[model samples]
Target: MTLTKLQKKFAEGIALGMKQGQAARYAGYSEKSADTQAYNNMKNVEILAFADELIEAQKSMLKRRFSGLASIAVDKTIDILQDVDASPQARLNAAKMILDYAGMEEPKQLNVTADVNQSNPFEGLTTDELRKLIDDG
Candidate 1:
């Protein structure tokens, strides 16, 4: 459901952390009715949904901004790693940061399972037999 301009303003104010009465006032509600309007608006499903949407949009924007900053930090670390005049310890730290950020600091472990009942096609073949089989194939 589309919200009216006042309802949208109330939702935005709430999303900005204003109290309901304050949000109602911000939405242009009269001073005498601000509290009553706020109480009523709180029960409005459309306003609540719009407030939630605003919060999610804010979260998404922050994530994108933080990611951009992280990329710049990684790039500066790369520069430190390549600087000839950087101290050995500093360069080592930078290299370690790059590796950690790239998720290469710890080696990944994998598990392999086999079915005991499965037959091995070449299990009984001798080396010369394997060679002939390969040649024929």
Candidate 2:
């Protein structure tokens, strides 16, 4: 999945923390609907895969940069959890810290469904009344 030059630039800009619209523009995508265009590009599977590779590389670099800190933090968190006198909130925080460090934390997806505007606006209307309403519309 090779990206064109513009696509490469767009992905790079995204990795560099630029907004999609700004990244698209930086990649020479000049359009009146730049935001929409950028959104479409970002949703492309190949582009997303490329971007993920770049992000994973950056994450690896950061992990190596903080190599020693991770183990120390995890050990301290385990100690906190095993302490009986720790506050409930403190224990919870320690749990979360370990989960986050282990990369087990993820945003939960919620599904919300609602029914609105269901009543017939022309309920109980006579034929003449309904015709009038349709004509008005």
lDDT of predicted model 1: 0.93
Model 2 segments beyond 4 Å from truth?
31-33, 71-137
> Per-residue CA lDDT of candidate 2, range 86-128, in tens?
9988998998888887889668999999978788877899999
Q: Which ten residues in a row have the lowest lDDT in candidate 1?
A: 99-108
Clash pairs of candidate 2? none
Candidate 1 lDDT by residue in tens digits, 1-137: 77899999999999999999999999999999999989999999989999999999999999987987987899899999999999999999999998888778656698999877878999999999999999999
Top-TM-score candidate index: 1
Error of 1 at 10 (Å): 0.1
State each model's CA lDDT, in order: 0.93, 0.85
CA lDDT of 69 in candidate 1? 91
> How many backbone clashes does every candidate have?
0, 0
